[model samples]
Target: MRVETVQLKGYTTLGVGGPAELWTVETPEDLKEAAQAPYRVLGNGSNLLVSDQGVPERVIKLGGVFTAWDLNLTPRNGAYITGWIGAGAMLPLLVQEAARKGLSGLEGLLGIPATVGGAVRMNAGTRYGEIADALEVVEVFHDGQLRHYRPEELGFAYRTSHLPPGGIVTRVRFRLTPSTPKAVREKMALVDQARKGQPKKKSAGCAFKNPPGDSAGRLIDVHGLKGLREGQAMVSLEHGNFIVNLGGATARDVWRLVQRIRSVIPLELEWEVWGVIE
Candidate 1:
């Protein structure tokens, strides 16, 4: 285990937050120690927003072996390819691996910048598919006890999965169909194409979850809230549901903009916030 005072802004995709004590844990025992410290886990920091003032809790980051995944598929069953993946592995790495190995799952998650553990815990997905579709079991280390769970036990929803408070995903099992590399790459390309027009600027992806039978972006667009700004934070003109950092935006700016949109549309937030804001 290692500890450092890291500027959280440098870690998050949205590019906000200040300094906080961050622990990098490489072993299972290290994870337990950090959890017992009541530390919060940080992955790729996608779909997350931290305070410019700094995070309230000590943060835990995975490194070393955690970032490694083993898919060694010399398939006994020609129909399916399965493997245990590390929590710290990025989604794009899996997507690329899937393409190379001709695995026909996780291709739809091509553009999401998320860690395997975080993505699975939240059931992250696109319109094409979700992590749950490929997920079989999750290996979790919580309160110094290791446990496993299936998709049904996690109570997965559109973009939510119920993990015990302070639970940390250690690894996961993914079952994927065996397809030709050409086919998998085609699917990946299709997913990439579907994601066009999102803002290229710094962001935490979609700020709000889509409401039932309606898209939050559509409603925000209908309300003419696109291009709305609060300090350096602004609703992206490209996509209404996205709050883009114009540059040097504080966490408060983003939170204030979120409140501004919620005042009008009453949408639920999708991004997980790590600090209190006034």
Candidate 2:
């Protein structure tokens, strides 16, 4: 284990945040040991936004053994394959691997920046599909014990899951079907093409979840909130649901923009924002 004051900005995809007491665990045993105490587990940091004041909680980042994955074809069921992926395994890499193996289910997640564990926890997805669609089981460590859980037990819905409190997902098993490589590639191509409208900048994916039957992006856009700015943060012109950090944005800058949007929209239908804000 390597311990240090790691800058949260470098860890997150948004490229903005203060420092945190960080520990990089290379083995499962170390990870479990670190979890024995109160700590936040970080994956690719794709869906997170830490405060500019820095996090006080100890942060544990998985590595080495935790990034390994195993793939096997089911016996007598040549059309089906099972993948056991570690929590730290990158989602985009996994999608590419699935395509290379002629797998079909994960092609829709081609461009998402997340880990298997994070994706499962958030039920991450795009219009094509959600991670819950292919997930079979999740292995997690919580309260000093490691356990396996099925999707139903997790209560997956929308962009959330009922994960155990302070639980650290260690691995995930996905059930996928066999398909032609060309078909899988084509599906991935479509997914990539659809993402063209998303800003290619520092952002924590979507800033909020859609409200009921309405899309958050549509609401924000229709209300003329796109391009709205606060300090260095601005609502993405390309996608209303995204808040991009322009060069030296702070957490407060993003929060200010969020508040501005909330002021105009009804509270009952307000977008649910994520991230740690002080």
Candidate 3:
């Protein structure tokens, strides 16, 4: 494992944040050693907003051995195929890999920029399906001890899974159904098509979770909050729920815009805030 002091803006999708001590742990033993010190596990750095002042704790990122995943195209007895994936494996690569392997279940996760562990931790999904739909077991290293947990035990809900505090997911096992190459590609295309409306700008994905029986985007749009801007951060006109970084936006700017939006309509924040927002 190697440690470096780097600007957090380069690590997150939002492109806003200050400096932090980042540790790249490549192996399980590396993770155990890193965990001995106070740390925070960072996935693909999506769906989060880190403070401009940065955090007092260290940020640990999985890599090397933790980025490996095993996927087999052929099933043993013409049944479901099981595979173990590292928490650090990027989802875009896995989605393409699965498609190439004639797998169709992950189509719903198209366009989500996240790691396997990050996707599972947040139950990342769209209308087609969720990551939890095919998940079986999650292996995590917590408090210097390794443990296996079923999905039910994690309390999976919409866009969120309740993992114990300081629990670092090391790997995950998934069960997927095989399909024809053409069919799998088609499903992925459809899922991608559905996501075409999302903003292409720098953002931490959706800014607010959809309230039950209602969408935060719809609410924001209906309230005429589209195009709302604070500093360099703005509510995307394409999708009201997205707060886009219009270049050089600060974390405080995004949070101020978020507060502006929240003032008009009550919506729960979907993005996990790091450090203080004020």
Model 1, span 203-234: residue lDDT tens: 99889999999999999999999999999999
Top lDDT model = 3
Report model 2's TM-score to 2 decimal places. Answer: 0.93
- Top-TM-score candidate index: 3
Name model 3 segments beyond 4 Å from true: 73-79
Per-residue lDDT of model 3, residues 199-232, tens digit only: 9999999999999899999999999999999999
Clashes of each: 0, 0, 0
Return whichever of 1 and 3 wins on TM-score.
3
Q: What's the residue-level lDDT of 112 in candidate 1?
A: 91
Q: Which residue pairs in candidate 1 collide? A: none
CA-lDDT, candidates in order: 0.87, 0.82, 0.89
Q: Candidate 2, residues 1-278: lDDT per residue as tens digits?
A: 88899888888888877888888888877887777666887878877777887777888988888899976656333446475789889999989988898887987677889988888878889888999998878998888788999889999998889989988888888888888789899998888898889999899888777887888889999999999999999999999989898998988897888789889875232122234675
Candidate 3 local lDDT, residue 34: 83
